[model samples]
Target chain A: AQSVSQHNHHVILSEAASLELGCNYSYGGTVNLFWYVQYPGQHLQLLLKYFSGDPLVKGIKGFEAEFIKSKFSFNLRKPSVQWSDTAEYFCAVIPLSGNTGKLIFGQGTTLQVKP
Target chain B: SQTIHQWPATLVQPVGSPLSLECTVEGTSNPNLYWYRQAAGRGLQLLFYSVGIGQISSEVPQNLSASRPQDRQFILSSKKLLLSDSGFYLCAWRSGTTGNTIYFGEGSWLTVV
Candidate 1:
């Protein structure tokens, strides 16, 4: 079974502050990585995903993530965050095999953006 | 546009009571359905997943069970609810076609007192 670990549990930042959240997954085989965000009272939205080709993937809301195979890590980053960026972030992964598509998620990082 | 619907965005039930949460997806067929539980301040735990009707897979043996009656409908049921089951229950689906993006529902918050 694959597991995802997120470094930060909670983060507080003022408007316009740069942001980066660390994520590491334990999967030895081919894997697909994703970064999801859940705003207050909203469904989880895809921030970005890494399947193949181009280790760097860009997502909605000016979010991007880099997949490093050797390190088994896919970290989310943003050049500048705003107050609207406050949300709960989750890192998820699934094996590239076709048997099952179940996702293993990280503990999540709560980001509080203050104006 | 494709949409996923989950009933009773918030639920409150007493311990030992029965539980049933329904989820349906529109604009898709033969989709892969999944049931996940998220405890407060915790990660998502996969409870069940179904590749097709009458094909259910249990990720972890616990107090919850899931069923897929139709191609786009999935249900999570419990014979007796437990306090530990108090959390956010999410139903998600992915296209049967070759893709890795999974869409989550609005989520059902269940509170077992």
Candidate 2:
């Protein structure tokens, strides 16, 4: 079955710490990838998306992700993380071979940034 | 800007009770609507999707059904709720002409006791 995987389940970091979250998918052909974040008591929001341009995509709040097609991986990264950055992150993708707008999302990664 | 509204924000239902979660989208037309469930360890499951009015596709077989009565209104219903049905249900939409980036609504928390 098609799936998206996020290896990190829960992560803890102190303020100003660098962060990296790994995401991988088992899909072939062209695909659209996305990163979404959900703060406490808030709805999910789009952080970034990769269609067909550069391998590295920049998003709001200084977060970025690099898509490696050979490995089927799209890893999210941040140079520094603040306590406010504590949230749940999800990786999602939609294969474009016979695409409809359906997205397959990972189990999600919970980040806890301490002050 | 496009916006999606899903409600009621939270609900508690007993087993065997009926369930109905409604969603509507504004600022866009003829969009693709979807229903997804977020469980603790199951990640996000695509329950259903619709491309047009009265056109619904079931992605998973469960105790749930969906309907798109109008162009921008999608509804998820279950005749009898089960304990396993308790989870976060999110309503999402994607532009038919714009891109594949799907936007989500404030999810509804369902707790079936």
Number of clashes in every candidate structure?
A: 0, 0
State the lDDT of candidate 2 residue by residue for A1-115, as single tens digits. Answer: 7789999999999999999999999988788899999998888999999998899999999999999999999999999999999999999998776546667899999999999
lDDT of 1 by residue, B1-113 (tens): 67899988999999999999999999988988999998987778889988899899998989998889899999999999999999999999988655558999989999999
- Candidate 1 lDDT by residue in tens digits, A2-113: 7899999999999999999999988888888999999988888899998899999999989999999999999999999999999999999987677677678899999999
Candidate 1 residue runs with Cα over 4 Å from true position:
none
Candidate DockQ scores, in order: 0.73, 0.65
Model 1 chain A worst lDDT window (10 residues)? A94-103
lDDT of 1 at B48: 94
- Given candidate 1, what's the lDDT at residue B53? 96
DockQ value of candidate 2: 0.65
TM-score of A-chain in each prediction?
A: 0.96, 0.98
The digit string of per-residue lDDT tens for model 2 on B36-64 reads: 99998677788998878998889888999
Cα deviation in Å at residue A103, candidate 2? 0.8
